[model samples]
Each structure stands twice: as C-alpha cells, then as structure tokens.
Target chain A: MDLSGLFAQVLNGLQYGLLLFLISSGLTLIFGVMGVINLAHGSMFMIGAYLAYVIASLTGALWLALPLAVLGGLAMGAALEAGLFRRFYKREHLDQVLLTFALILLFEEARSAMLGNDFHAVPVPAILDFSVPVTAEFAYSAYRLAVLVVCLFVALLMFLGIERTRIGSAVRAAAEKPEMVDLLGLDARRIHLLVFAVGTALAMLAGALAAPLQSVYPNMGESFLIICFVVVVVGGVGSIAGAFWAALLIGLVDTLGKAYLPEIAGLVVYLLMAGVLLWRPSGLFAPGR
Target chain B: MTPPILEARGLQAGYGEGLVLRGVDIAVRPGEAIGLMGRNGMGKTTLIRTLLGQLPARAGQVLADGRDITREATFRRAQRGIAVVPEGRGVFASLSVMENLLLAARPDADGRTPWPLERVLTTFPRLAQRARNRGDQLSGGEQQMLAIGRALMTNPRLLILDEATEGLAPLLRDEIWRTIRTIREAGLACIVVDKTVGAVLSVVDRAEILVKGSLVWSGRPDALRADPELMHRHLGV
Candidate 1:
C-alpha cells in the first residue's frame, strides 16, 4: 500500500474502532453493572441507522435526526429495562438470552412492518461532504474525520461522566457490588435504569453516525452484534476503558487485516481475542488487584 | 420504653424452603446499640437482611421510626437513615477509598450533614492516607473501617454492621471494636452482629441471642454475662 493509502487505512481503522467503542462501551457497562447480557445492543445501532434514514429523508437533514435518534434510544432503553431487563437481572443467562433474542426478532419484525425490509441509504450531511487537503494528491474524507471527532467527543464526555461525577462513581460501585449499593441506600434501580438507558442511547448514536458510511438493511444489527460481544469480552466484562482500548485494537486489526491480508482477515480479530485471553483472562483492565 | 426506631415483628424468612429466620423479632431504639449474636446458620444475618429489606419477611412486618416499611425498597430504607456495613465488608473493590466514601455521601433526612467526607476521613486516618487505593487493596481491618466510614457518609440514624470484625487480626479486631464503640458513642443507633461474644457484650446496651432462627434471649449485657449456661447452650462460644 502507498503512504497515503496506509494513512487512510489507519484513519479508517480508528474511525471503525471509535464507532465500535461507542457501541461496546454500552455493552460492557450493561453487562458489567446490570449483569444483563444485552444481545440486542447491535439492534440499537441498527435502529439508529433506520432512524437516521427516516429522519434524513423526512426533514432532509441528518443533524435533527441524530438527537431524535438519541432520545428514541434513551426512551427505548428505559422502557426495556423497566419492562423486560429488570426482571431478568437475576434470572439465568439462558433466560436472558431467550429474552434478548426475542427482542431481536421483535425489533426485526417491527422494522419490516414499519420501514419494510428494503435496503436504504442516508445521505451524508452536505456540510461534511468535502475532503481535507492532507496532501496535494491525497486528502481525507471530511465525513470520516467528522465521525472520528464526534465519537471522540462522546467518548470524552463518557469518560468525564463515568469517572469524574458522583453518579459515575456510584455506577462504578454498582458494577462491583450492586447489593452493597442498595444497602448504602443509593437506589440501585435508578442506577440500573440510568446505565441501561445510557448504554442503549450510545449504541443507537453509533448506528445513527454510521448510517451514511454503511447503508442500512434488514438484520444489520446481527452483523455488529457478535463483534461487539467480542469487544466486551476482550475488553473485560465490566471495564469501560478496557472496552475502549480493546475496541480500537480490534478495529485496527480487523480493518488493517482486511486491507492488507484479505484471506486471513476474518481470523485475526478472534486470534487477538484469544491472545488477550491467554495473557489476561479477566481482560486488559480488569477491575481488581 | 422508647418506641423502636427500627423493629421487626414475626420476621419469618428463609432460603427456598429451608427457613432461616422463623418468627424472629427484634427492635432498636434511637441511639441504642444491639449485639445480634448466634452461631453459624442461626439466622442472625438473615434477620439483618430482612430488617434492611434485602430479604422479604414472609409473615411479618418491619417498621422504621414507627412507620410500616415492610414494603419499602432497600434504598428507601437507607433514605430513612438505615445503613449496613454488611458481611464481607461489601466495599466497592474497584473504587478508590475516596470514591467509595463519596459515592454514598448525603445529608440526613432533616438536611443535616453530620457525617461528611472530611469527618469520616478524620475518623479513619488510615483511610485518609490511602484515599486513592482501591477497596480490594485495603487490608481486612482497613476494609472494615472503610465500610463503616462509607455507611457513616450517608449520615444514617441507624447503622448495621454484620460481621463487623469477622476476619481481622487480634490487633485489627481491637481497632474495629474501638471504632464501633466510638460510632456508638457518637449517638448513632446500631445493630452489630459478631462472633466475639465478650467484645459484643462490652459495647451493646442490649444483647439479643438467636438460636435455630428464633430470638431466644434478649436483655442487658450484664444479664447475658450472668447466664453462662444460657450462652454455652445457644452461642457455643
């Protein structure tokens, strides 16, 4: 690959990883704090794309669609936690799997009924349509750069929110010992609700942001779902920072692998996961001493 | 007699068909210290769990400050100024000493900040030195102190300490017992469950004994000491 091509691929890897982090950060938290395996996380992303597509088409603007998608995700997450995930927190993993899997079908059917199973595309906001002149002959796509900036901004906000605030500490505390949180009289339900809602909104936001990059279609959530689980496991079951770095590493490996070693691309990310597990079974940033 | 700030009447609870607390009843008046004593599997912890609303009372009621709180959630009970430094220390292992203390810090019901972070850190100067260390990094004695300090941060009117000094060295255990005495002296109502019979007797105003999930005895600590046969029969200490 040429110098510019390598740089573009590296950027592509970072962008892809950031997007994965947006989604996997939620996945790890929902699993870590709430102890609920949210198999439908990718569906949040898929729904975001569909929401983006619908909104962009209706209002002819992606910006308005973004906030609406976020709002929709938050409400959706809150509703799901209250109605479904709340009850399943203590249930066996088999039951949780059944519940979330049912949700995937429900979402897919609803998507088909509401938007039809047709492939759709969201137009990039006209403002970000141009490229930055990195080199005279080679430049970076402004849209991809914008996605990277937005993802990083969100990541920074999440870092500050989870690390610097009282609620953030409580969430971290809950992730370690939920019953203890309740014993402290901190209302574990509210914490769970907050974590779930935020997780859902994040996944959806990732999807909404990615809609222009990757066209939307039926079961689009399924494609990202397994990879997200990988990210969650490799990052550590409940560590957000772990998920962040792990997602980036996976993204670079997957993107660069496909770019450079096409035939073995599919095998590399899993190999990385295997390697990480072999080295640190709990995860890269496991919670304890 | 003063009305109990916390009370459990006929608390019948257990795990999945095996009853642990069979018709157990206990109460703690304002600023009263209680030693809930028993051997292993005698439902001492179960009774505490039921009072805190972590375990449901199958056929009884829990009242807080004379109000029925049987149906209240655990956090709601905490909002009412009930806090437990549960068994196993229950510290947030991944969180720093400061974070764990600050996470649950709040003004009491009447908008009082009696147990702020500064006061708590002062109380446990050992904790002050290790404010940035994670909970798991603390020694057993330090973890127990952190748990108590964290509970104090809530400005709880009533604090429960299950296994307050379960697995500490003799010196650390002495340190915890001193702290517990200090907490009781600071005018906080407390429920302490510990295997150290002599230590428990020294601190609590009243001693309540459980045997096979029933409150078989309750009286002054001296009264408990007078009945060695009773202690040998129930406590096995």
Candidate 2:
C-alpha cells in the first residue's frame, strides 16, 4: 500500500482499538474485580447507539444527545446492577454467564419492541464532518480523529482513577482482598455497585460515540461483542493498560489485514489472539493467578 | 469487671456442614490484650472470621461495645471500631503501599483521630522508604507491618491479628512481637493468634487455648505459662 494509505489505515486502527479499549476496560474491571462474566455488556453499547440515534433525531444536536445517552447508560447500568447483577455476586461463573447471555436476548427484544427492527443512524456533528488531507489522494475524516482524541482522554482518566485515587485503591483492594477492605471500613458492596455502573456507562459511551460511524441495529452489538472479548482476553483479564495496548494491536491488525490481505482478513485477529495465548495463557499483562 | 468491648456468646460457626467453632465463648475488655492459641484446625481462625462477619454465625451472638453486632455487615463492624489484620496479610496487591495505608485511614464513629500517616511512617521506617511501592512488592515482614499499620489507621477499638508472624524470619518475628507490645502499651484492645506461645504470651494480658473447636483454657498469661502441659495438649507446641 502507498504511504498515505498506510498512514490512514494506521489511524483507523488506532481509532478502532481505542474504541475497543473503552468497552473492554469496563468489561475487564467488572470481570477481574467483581468476577462477573457479563456477556450482555455489548447490548449496553447497542442501547447507547440507539439512544444517541433517538436523541439526535429528537433534538437535532450531537452535543445534547451525547450527555443524554450517557445518563441513559448510567441509569440502565445502576438499575440492572441493583436488580439483577447484585444477586449473582455469590453465584458460580456458569450461572453468571448464562444469566448475562439471557440478558442479551432480553435487551435486544426490548429494543425491538420499543424502536422496531429498522436500522437507524446518527448524523456526524457538522464541526467534525470535514477532513484534513494526508496526501494528494487521501484525507482522513476529522470525526474519526475526534473519536480517537476523546477515547484516549477517557482511557487516561480511567488509568489515573484506578492508579492514583483512594476510590481506585478501594476498588483494587476489593478485587484482591474484599474482606480486608471491609475490615478497613469501606463498604465493598457500594464500591462494587459503582464499578458495575461505571463499566456499563463506558460500554454505552463507546456505542454512542460510534453511532455516526456505524449503523444502529438491534443485533449490531453481536460482532463487536466477540471482538471486545478478544481484546480483554489478549490485554490481560483485569489490567487497564493491558486492554489499551491489546485493543490498539487488534485494531491495527484487523484494519490493515482487511486493506492488504482481503482473502484472509477475517482470520487475522483470531490468529493474533491464538499466538498471544500460546505465548502467555493468562494474556500479555494479567496479574499472577 | 469492665463491660467487654467485644463479647461472643456461645458463637457457633463452620463451613458447609462441618462445624469449626463449636459454641466458642470469648470476651475482650477495652485496653485488653488476648492471645488466642490453638493447634491447626482447632477453629482459632474460624472464631475470628465469625466475629468479623466473614463467616455467618451458625448460631449465637457477637456483641461489640455492649451492642449486639451479630447482624451488622463486616464494613459496618469496622465503622464501629473493629478491625483485623487478617491471616494472609490481605494486602491490595494492585495498589501502592501509600494508597493501601491511606485507604484504611478513617476516624472511628466517636470522631477520634485515626493513626496519622506520620505515626505509621515513624513506627515503620522501612515502610516510609517503600511508600510508593505496590503491596505485592513488599517483603513478607513489610507486608505484616503494613497490615498492622493499615488496621491502626482505622482507629479501631478492637484489633484482631491472625497468624501475625507466620512465615517470617526470627528477626522479623521479633520485630512483630515488639510492635504488638507497643500497641498493647498504646491501650488498644487486641486479639492475637500466633503459634509461638512464648512470643505471644509476652504481650497479651490473658490467653485462651482452643482444642477440637472448644475453648479448653482461658486465664491469665502467667497462669498458662505455669502449666506447660496445658499448652502442650492444646497448642501442640
């Protein structure tokens, strides 16, 4: 491929990877810290996209829709956590997986009932609709660049929050030594609820941000769901930094493979995961088991 | 006699159908130090877990500061001035040493000041050198000190330490025992579990020996020291 084309593909990979990181970081936190395998997390992304679509259509502004979609995600996450997820804390992983998988169908059906099965789209905010030229024949969309910047900022915030703050310390402690955290006077249950809500909100935020780039459909989350699991597994189960690196790698490989090796493009990400797993069964940066 | 700060009345608990603490009764008054002694699997740890609400009491009551706290959550119990260093140190491996210490620092319900960061640093100068390090990075002795320091930060009325000096070198164990003496002198109520009878006996005012999930002896430390055969039978030491 040409230099400009390669550069554009690289940018695309970074953008894709960052978006995957947005969703996977939350997934890993929920899994690693709380030990809940929530297969329905992708549905939150779908719901966020749908919420963005509805809000943008109603208000005719991306700015308003974004915040509303975030609130929508937060509310959904909190409600689900208190009502359903809280009950499963002591249950086995098999039960958690089965319950969360069932939630996927429940959310999909609920969305269909409310919005029908028709595809929907969100218009790119006019400010980011334009593009800057990379070369004589190539220009990268400014909206994609904006997505990259925003997702990067979010990832940085999450990293700082987990690494530098007292709340983050408690969350980390709850993951490793929950009883100790309790003995230290912090309610592990409250921390857990917050993690679940924040995790769900993050998945939604990624979906809302991707709404303009991808069509919003009832089952649109299914494909992204599998890819996200790959990102989390490759990044290390609960490591935030690991997810960031793994997402970028997967995004670049998937994007470049599709552009340069069309026939085997679909096989590239799985091959990468397989290679990494062979080298490190616990993923690249997983904490000692 | 002073009203006990912590009292377990016929506490019964276990794991999945196998009873571990069979009607164990114990009490700790304010500013008292107790050395809980037993051989392996005699329910020394189980009693502690039950007191902290980590294990559900199959039957009986745990009264904290004259209030029945049997139904309170573990964190609530901590809020009420109860803390445990725990058997495994239970450090947050993902967090920094400073963060672990800070996270546990909170005033008790009566608004008494918790252990200041400076105090912990002074008490454990080695911890001061490794404040920025993660919990997992610390050596076993440092981790033990951190555990005790973390519990102290809570300004607890009752401090529980299980296996406080397990798997440490003799020097490290000596340091831990000396620290326990200092804490006792500081007038905090403490329940300590250790295999070394002599070391624990030095700090605690009284001793309780458990055998086959039952308290076989509860008396002054010197009283137990006077009867070596009692220690031999219950503690196998």
Candidate 3:
C-alpha cells in the first residue's frame, strides 16, 4: 500500500484498539479480580450504544448523550451485580457463565422490545463532523480521531485511578486475596460492586463513542464483544497494561490483516490470536497475582 | 479472668458431608496466650474456621466479649475485634505490603485508639523494608509477619493465628515467637497453633490438645510439658 494509505490504516487501528481497550479492560479486571466471567458484559456495551443513540436522537446533541449513556451503563451493571452477580459470587464459574449468558439473551431481547430492530446512528457533534487532511490527497474523519483521543484520555485516567489512589490499592488487594481484604475489615463485596460498575461504565462509553462510527443496532455490541474477548485473551486475563498493549497490537493486526491478509488467502485475526497463544498461553502479560 | 474475651462452646463444624471438628470448646481471656495443639487432621484448623465463622458451625455458640456471635458474618465478627491470621498467611498476593496492612485498619470500639499504618511498620520492621513489595514477593517468614501485622492493623481484642510458623526456618520461628510474646505483652489475647509444642508451651498460659475432631486434653502448659509420652502419643512425634 502507499504511504498515506498505510498511515490511514494505522490511525484506524489505533482508534479501534483504543475502543477495544476501553471495553476489555473492565472485562479483564472483573475476570481477574472477582473471577466472575460475566457473559453480559457485551450487553453493557450494546446498552451504551443504544442509550447514546436514544439521547442523541431526542436532544440532537452528542455531548448531552455521553453522560446519560455512561450512567445508564453503570446502573445496568450495578443492577445486574446486585440482583444476579452477587448471588453467583460463591457459585462455580460454570454456573456464573450460564447465568450471565442468560442475561445476555434477556438484555438483547429487552433492547429489541424497547428500541425496535431498526439501526440507528448517533450524530457526530457538528464540531467533529469535519475531515482533517492526513496527506496531500488523503483525509481522515475528525469524529473518529476525536473518539481515539477521548478513549486515550479515559485510559490514562483509569490507569491513574488504579495506580495512584487508596481505592486502587484496595482494588489490587481485593483482587489478589479477597479473604484478606475482608479480614482487613473492608467489605470486599462493595469493592467488587464498584469495579463491576466502573467496568460497565467504560464499556458504555466505548459503545457511545463507536455509535457515530458504526450502526447502533441491537446486535452491534455482539460483534465487538467477540473482538473484546480476543483483546482480553491476547492481553492477559487481569493485567490492565496487558489489555492496553494487546488491544493496540490486536487492532493493528486486525486492521492490517483485513486489508493485507487476503494475499496469503487463509490467515485472519483468529489466526493471529492462535499465533500469540502458541507463544504465551496465558496471553502476553498474565496477571502476576 | 474477665469472662474471657472470646469463647467457643461445644463447636462442631466441617466441610460439606465430612465433619472436621466435633464438640470442640476453647476460650481466650483478654491479654492471655493460648496454644492450640494437635497432629494433622485433628480439627485445630477446623476449630479456627468455626471460630472465625468462615465455616458454619454444625452446632455450638461463639461469643466475643459476652455477645453470641455464632450467627454473625465473618466480616461482622471481624468488626467486633476478632482477627485471624489464617493458615498460609492469607496475604493478598497482588497488593503491596502497605496496602495489606491498611485494609484492616479499624477504629477501636470506644473510638479512642486506631491501629495506624506507622504503628504496624514499627511492629514489623521487615514489612517496612518491603513496604512496596507485593504480598507474594515476601519470603515465608516475612509473609507471616505481614499476616500478623495485617491482623494487628485491625486492633483486634482477640487475635488467632492458625499454623503461625509451620514452614519457617528456625531463626524466623524464634522471631515469630518473640513477636507473639510482644503482642501478648501488649494485652492482646492470642490463639496460636503450631507444631513446635515445646516452644509454644513455653509462651502460652494454657494449651488444648486435640485428637481426631475433639478436644482430648486441656491444662496449663507445664502440666502438658511434664508428660512427654502423652505429647508423643497424641501429637505423634
């Protein structure tokens, strides 16, 4: 490919990677720390996109929809945790998987019943609707670039929140030894709830941002969910840094693979994951704890 | 002497379908040191689990400061000043040493004294040296120290250490013993379980010997130590 075409693909990869990181980081955190494999995590992403679409449609303003989408995602995560996840905390992983899988079906059906099956698009704020010149004859959408920047900012904030604060320390402690966290007189259940909520909120934010770039259909997050799992698996189960780096690598591989892998005529993103797993069975950065 | 700070009466508990403790009774007076003695599979660990409410007691009552605590959640029991340095040290492997200590800090019942981070560091200098190290990084002895310090951070009225020094080197075992003595001197009641019967006997006010899933013998440390044959028969070397 030409230099400008390659540059555009790189940017696309970065944007896609950043969004995947936002969604998968939460999934990995919950999985690593709580050991709960929540199948409904993707539903949270879909709900975010739907909420953003609804809010943007009603208010005709993208900015007005973002917070609503995030809050809605948080509420949904908290409700699911309180009502179902809490009950399964002590249950086996198999049971948790079954229950959350059921939740995914329920959430998808509920979304269809409430919002209908029609595809929707969130309005890219007029400020970001313009295109920016990348090369003499090439241009990239300002909206996609803005989504990349916003996701990067969120990732930075999340990193800081996990690394620099007392709550972050508690979260790490809880993740490592929940029994110890409880013995320390801190309610581990509360920390689990907080992490789940935050993770869901991030997923929602990703969904909301992606709404402008793609159709906000009921099944929109289903595809992204599979991609997010690939991100989680490639990164490592519990390592945020792993998720970030892996997401970027996967994004690049996926974007470039779709564009360039046709020449080889057989390999795909799944092939790339298979290659990574062959080398590091636990993903590139397995959680040290 | 003050009706014992903690007491477990007629306790029976076990994992699903397989009972490990049967009608075990143990008590710890405020500022007193009690040693729990038993061979492997003799219900010492099970009794500790029952006392902490981690394993439900099939039958019995647990009391702390004269209040029935059998039905209280493990966290609730902890809030009432019962801290356990569980077997295997139970340190949060992912958290730094400082974070583990801080997680257990709670205000005293009268709200007079709190177990601050600095106090814990002072008590366990090894932990201070490795403050930033993750829980899993510490050696066995240091992990045990962290476990004790983690328990102390809650300012518990009664502290229970199950298998406190099972896998430590000789020097580290001596250090742990010194620390336990220091804690006892500070007026904190302790329930210590260890294989070193001679060492624990020298430190504790009383000792309870268990066989199978029941308390087989109970008396002053001197009484048990005087009978080496009795120790060998029940403890099996």
Residue-by-residue lDDT tens digits, candidate 1, B97-188: 99999888889999999988888988999999999998889898899999999999999999988988888999999989998999999999
User: Between 2 and 3, whose DockQ is larger?
Assistant: 2
Deviation (Å) of A217 in candidate 2: 1.6
Query: Which residue pairs in candidate 2 have backbone atoms (N, alpha carbon, C) closer than 3 angstroms, thus clashing?
Result: none
Off by over 4 Å in 1: A275-279
Local error of candidate 2 at residue B184 (angstroms): 0.6
Docking class of 3: medium
What is the DockQ for all candidates, taken in turn? 0.78, 0.78, 0.59
- The local distance difference test score of each candidate is 0.90, 0.87, 0.84
C-alpha-based local distance difference test score of model 3: 0.84
Docking quality category of candidate 1 according to DockQ thresholds: medium
Q: Tens-digit lDDT track for model 2 on B1-237? A: 667988999999999979998898899999999999988888999999899888999899999877899988888888888889888898888788899899998887778784788987888988899999988888999999999998988888889999999999999999998898888888999999998989888899999988878898899999988887887777776
Error of 2 at B29 (Å): 0.6
Instruction: Look at candidate 3 and tell me the lDDT of residue A272.
Output: 65
- Please give the distance, in angstroms, between residue A89's alpha carbon in candidate 3 and its true position after superposition: 1.8
Alpha-carbon shift of residue B149 in model 1 (angstroms): 0.6
Which residue pairs show collisions in model 3?
A184-B104
Task: Indicate the worst ten consecutive residues by lDDT in candidate 3 chain A.
Answer: A260-269
Query: Cα deviation of A218 in candidate 3 (Å)?
Result: 2.9
